[model samples]
Target: MFLVYVDESGDTGLVNSPSNYFCLSAIVVHESHWQTTLNSVIGFRKELRASYGFKLREEIHCSHFIHKPGDFQRIPKSLRLRLLRDVIDFQASLLNYQIVNMVVNKKNKSLNSDIFSLAWQTLIQRIENTLYHHNFIGSNNATDSALLFVDKTDEIKLRNLTRRMRRYNPVPNSFNLGSGYRMMPTQWVIEDAIHRDSAHSYFI
Candidate 1:
């Protein structure tokens, strides 16, 4: 079995979003390595507290780290930079993982209003390729399945869009992740979207 962790940066709102780009990123990993990866992350958190006297309960948020807010305000700039670097290194150390990222340029005034759907479509296609080629679970096995985990904020809307696309051919005769042409229905994607706190969300 494979687990897909997904997260997005930037707001989907047309008018309120301060940023010009919206990015969606996903990390796919096999079940066997999940515990190792989770432990590595937990270890990193503990190391920060033990070595730097940082708060163990606090999450390392980029905005808070960079801006040095509240408890972070007392951290030295050098230490903050090092923390960021170590976090990046930890992410790079994951083995047998595939990353799928989509960046939407919202500068164009004529861009589609449903930019979120567009980004999701691209990500799903890449995910489909990973599922088809990677036979870690087994070749054409009926039990082949992947679970998608995302933040709770968008669970309802994202699931609605995903199910709609899966049920109907929104883009007929075009590149898509549907099971129309494959034995394994892309519908293998679980409808029950799992959600977690941003702090615990490694994908974010």
Candidate 2:
């Protein structure tokens, strides 16, 4: 089994929006390595607490951390940059997980386009394809089932989209001679995505 943690950046709005692109990122970790991976993250957070007086439970919002907003104001800019670099290095050092990311350019999209749905659909398809081919841990034949945990920003919309896809997802039939799509219901992912508050869940 695998646990998939998902988060998004930017807004779905195409007009007068702060960002022109929307990105969805997923971190996939196998069941066998989940505990060790979590322990490593907790250890890293403890290191931050000891070195910079950062709280272990404090959520690390990238924008606020970089901009030094609110509670982050006391942290010097130079230390913030160093901390960011350390985070990058730590993430790079992890070997038991996979990162899947999808970005939608809203600049060229129509005003009526559903940017959120499109981005999630593509991302889910990519994840499904990956799991179908490789769902093993070392020599063990683990179950290919995966569970998704997303930041609770659009619970209803995301749940509906995921449920619909599980029922009747379609994909291009590359093996066919003609241009046609084929039903490809989700196989690896189980049930609707479980939403969580990012502030509460360190994994999110």
- What lDDT does the true structure give each of the candidates? 0.69, 0.85
Tens-place lDDT per residue, model 2, 1-204, is 788999999989988999999999899888889899899999999998887777888887778887645787778877877877888899999878888999999999998999999999999988888878884332245456889999966888888888998889988878655788989998888888988888877778
What range of 10 consecutive residues in model 2 has the weakest lDDT sum?
Answer: 135-144
**In candidate 1, where is summed lDDT lowest over 10 consecutive residues?**
178-187
Which candidate leads in TM-score?
A: 2
Per-model TM-score on C-alpha atoms: 0.79, 0.92
Q: What residue runs in model 2 are displaced by over 4 Å at the alpha carbon?
A: 135-142, 174-178
Which residue pairs overlap in candidate 1's backbone?
none
What lDDT score goes with residue 90 in model 1? 73
